[model samples]
Target: MTVDRRGVLLAGTGGAFGLYSWAAGAAAPAPKRLKLRRRHGVRPKNILVVLTDDHRYDAMGFMKAQSFGDTPTLDRLAREGVHFRNAFVTTALCSPSRASIFTGLYAHQHRVVDNNHPIPPGLIYYPEYLRAAGYETALIGKWHMGVETDTPQPGFDRWVSFKGQGDYLPGPNGLNVDGAKVPQRGYITDELTDYALDWIGKRSGKRPWMLHLAHKAVHSEFIPAERHKGRYTNQTFRYPDSMRPKVPGRPMWVENQRNSWHGVGYPYHGTLDVGDYYKRYMETLLAVDEGLARIMDLLARRGELDDTLILYMGDNGFMFGEHGLIDKRAAYEESMRVPMLMRCPSLFGPGEVSQVVANIDVAPTMLAAAGLVAPDGLAGADMLPLARGEEAPWRTELIYEYYWERNFPQTPTVHALREDRYKYVHFHGIWDVDELYDLATDPNENNNLLARPGHEELAERMSAKLFRLLEETGGMQIPLSADAGERNELRDPKGPAQAPFPPRFFRPPGT
Candidate 1:
């Protein structure tokens, strides 16, 4: 089915995207237009995009993460530019989310559902659009789309990347600097920043430039730079409210997940210490902030800080013991909601934007900023109008999908729909019950309202909307490919794993 999401909302990361709407009645917000209206009908000449892995929506100091202080740089951006308080990624996984950001298409459209899949050779990445428009483009670090190679892809002129999850330490296999095997001497985060700075200083581009500075820090095995190793040792790290998933109304799957590979109870088959884990994760991010500062300083030195669009986001969010899960892909808010901030001082003034945005919007927004229109089938809208608080129809709901992954098989395939105040989750290939939450009241999503009598109609409405999105996006029908030798070949071998949520929400005979 062809999904007419132009005026609506639909997005997917691994397998599906979300559909969103306002809760019941929400007065339209005032337009927040920028002062610098596209110089000569073209965006600024320089654009710097920095992407991180596993950075959650509330992880920054400005968001008031409990006991997690000292993100002054990120907080400054929130203070100086537009803060997307409701940012999310449709599929909350690394490869798929990154691909969505590059192509402006959902995971199913671009066909990179999981970490192992590759984009088709002919697919055009937005970098190609920028490069074709005479902008010098470069990609530095962590380009793990498919088959993890450091060789250059379609878009960028200069490439600096490594194999899957490049080591935090400068190992024997250093960075692949534009196809040359260059040795590394410093921390990977700092080293990556050095390469990016060098390129920014030396690039021969009178006609604008775009830099994709993707970082490898703050992923698993959180490694902090030497200077920051013990920075937070004395501070107390606070745990999430839902860290202990002993609540009665919680669904069976959420309860069972605590003992799995990605569970807080048994993280990576070792001791799971939430406090220590939080500390290490926060420490690792310190270097990322320092790197951002250096980049901003570079832009300021070149007299382009205010004029350039500097966007920061995470590829996907990480689950920090929310729903008893410690990793992404569970259709929970912790796994999907990401940090997004954009600052171009001369163009956009400081303010907070409550409109929902996603990774898929990045490509189209960048293309539009460069005075180019997105391709025909792009699933996301250019966010310039929304960012400017201009009067354009913004997203009302978000649709999300996640195909089961072989590496982490505990979590089932999922489809979800979220709006201003509610979230509906449907599990595929699992016997567990579906979940419904009134996010306005239960922001932590601790209470499940699926079986409650009074909430049935609301579930029915949300479920119907979810399936409409599924049919339109070809979400349920899309097939995944994998290697037989790798033991990742997928064919549901059990009792035709039923869609846990009824097509139109209804109770069973017993209920």
Candidate 2:
């Protein structure tokens, strides 16, 4: 089936590329007129994008993935604007995902597949287009693209950022404030918000502004603010069912990882409990929630709350004891899907958008809101029409890729095809069995159906489609850069036993 620009379903050729062309084709064109025009006249809209690290999709009060997750501010954004319930990232890592958001290209396309890689030269960030269109741009908080420096990059008028995965508290070397090193005054979350609000309030001209307030909270070694510390210490956690030991049909490598660094039995060197770690992560997220409230309040007080386009999203989703894993860089739902909410009453009203949107779509959406078109060859479409409840042709499947890192070798390279109701994950350079899950029936991915009696053709078709996406999008070659960060492949001496090889690997007596 092929969908046209008007979203009309039509009969099409039946081939590998015929049925799935629209999903992996070039981005759809923008509407003839955007929603940036106001009642008074045509004017560009202000944009504010707030990003958090390792936030899960259902970790909000409304979604209730956690029993004690409180996010009144984020809930308000979903209540007042468009909630992208099915948002995901192509690569579930900090630098690669952030690079995708800025450049509107896949990690392989932009050549920033790993955290230590730098943004390839001559690549223009979409914010530069917004700046060229007479809008001021500012970047505050974490910019983990090029792990070497915190100095300002192009496309932003004002810059306030820190080094890679900056310290939760003030460190020996403080923040880099527009080419100067300054002492971090308070908690990283609140201090980043202070810089963001200061920049937003100090603009003196009539030009619309774009601010990217990225927070470093909620990352590993989680540390909550003074007021929010131990907030969820007493709350109970609802662990995932897939975390059970010796789950039937579970991949052997996933079971073996239970004793590795990212596994549940020995998470963070066996010194961390999954429940306590999860509580701390949620607690650390509280300050980010409060910061959102403050930004919204300031915009409301200035009478621009409804007019300004505000977006709240996460760089990548974190896992909590899912499939015996604790971090991202895997193809599981909890590791790739993130919370994405956008509010601009001038563009759209309160509702939910069910389409599968990715981090690569953010750049085009922001450019569309500012009445500017994104550059050619972007891998994402303008999602404003979908947010406005308009019928538009969209992708039916998303390709997720994660390159193997020398720092964390427990998880292998992953390339998966995620459809609405099914997923097929392929592992590279490993001897483990691949995974296939019927998400509609088994959302937890407890039962892998790769060896099922009647699902062989389904898995074969999906696997073929997965590789075609990579071959078509120039992702066939893996990009390698200088390896950095500490190697964390160490396993606890007395942890759980390594998973044995699958029984299928052994031959029958007759054979």
Candidate 3:
């Protein structure tokens, strides 16, 4: 497992599906709507994406977190486009990273790995292959992968959302739209951008659309939008490097999460004040950066804003006090790195890419920005030709997972891999001692160089390249979803109201 393969695997696409052409097999099956096979874009462009919930990866303002709390439209979208600077989310919660960004697989091949885990009847939802290729797909807000029904599934033709982790408070559990629940009154990120500009003022723009929005902003009970409540209360938060308490080798399941329940030494049981929880998750990300400047002024007033591709991200990454943990299922690096960006100034220009993208490469880079095709095993990587600088065959090693939830049960069932500046991790049902982290001289992983004595052959060659990338991305099962029985813990807002919520994850004994 020295990580090298010629002709990067295809055919029944389990691994490097970055090689497309339906990864040598499965294709014909998306048309639950538009039915397209011809207009492979020399024209049909449009695609918005956004997605926020628990938005981390240094809560924007261009990776300068602390008092630099502001994201003028995601810092002018990272100074106008492309900042992939190592994005991630192989499964760092929130409906298995939004079902690995709408099914490019892996949450153990889309069994919807936990969080009301349902959708497993032979998955598929890269906007149903862009509404069967003629685009015009639309899934507006937080559709927490079939949990308590927002009811309007199968690949969009306009379907705003709600139910499960929604409610940035447009009047408690409202807006369902395409299936009509509607009630949405005030601020749930400005009424999902005023019902996405009233569905782009009733579009008849003929094809090319993909919307997706998905916000439920800055998760956790951190509701900001009272004009960003007490705005960053005179800042001051920084504290990361495994929030101290003797580091140099910290990993006894991160010292058994200091008394559990997502413990930053007693978090859920109270006391989380990382200076008022990073000032209400950076003031609930300034109304998701003013609803991305009102959807970039509604895509520059529908002139399609320099030929639409836009993106933004984060269905994962969020852990304030770091390994003392705050939220997000931890494989750590602040719970699976996130914040990605992308734009489309007539195809691709801006800067900062760094590679390592994830959340299964946003549904084959939104089915290759609407030109469609990525189907087969779809594990993900059409990062639009690595965000259009071209040259394919990317991914050097990245695999992360997190499965211990019966309501956080003190973090376990892990597996990590990062490669190039190392990372390793591996814990699964915990017996301890296996961590590596030389993120090139401890990039804030606080130096747990695994049994360091000259790093025992780099931790046995990254534990055989983390089980050969968990058998080339199928993640070798164990993602556990044999009807995870008594479910309902969508970060617990009394969804399944088990009355007084105690550990309750059940369903574990051989399912």
lDDT of 1 by residue, 1-511 (tens): 1223221122223333321122323233233111222335665448899999999888898788776656888998999988999899989988888888987877766667888765543455788777877789999989988757777776788899998789999887888887898887889999999988999988555778999999997798899999998878788876777876556566666666676667766676667686778788889999999999998998789877888888999988888777777878878888899999999876668888888789989988887777776666677888878778788987788888788876667788888999888999988887667889989898888888975557889999999998887677666654455542143223233311222332234547897
- Ordered by lDDT, highest first, the candidates read 2, 1, 3
When 2 and 3 are scored with TM-score, the better candidate is 2
Each prediction's RMSD to truth: 9.1, 7.6, 20.6
Quote each prediction's TM-score.
0.87, 0.91, 0.34
Where does candidate 2 stray beyond 4 Å?
1-42
- In candidate 3, position 369 carries an lDDT of 68
Q: In candidate 2, what residue range of length 10 has the lowest lDDT sum?
A: 30-39
Local distance difference test values of all predictions, in order: 0.77, 0.84, 0.71
In candidate 3, position 174 carries an lDDT of 83
Give one digit per residue, the lDDT tens place, for model 3 in 34-93: 343443445657888888987878778767867558887887877878888888888888
What's model 3's TM-score? 0.34
Show pairs that collide, candidate 2. Answer: none
Quote the positional error of residue 480 for candidate 1 in Å.
3.3
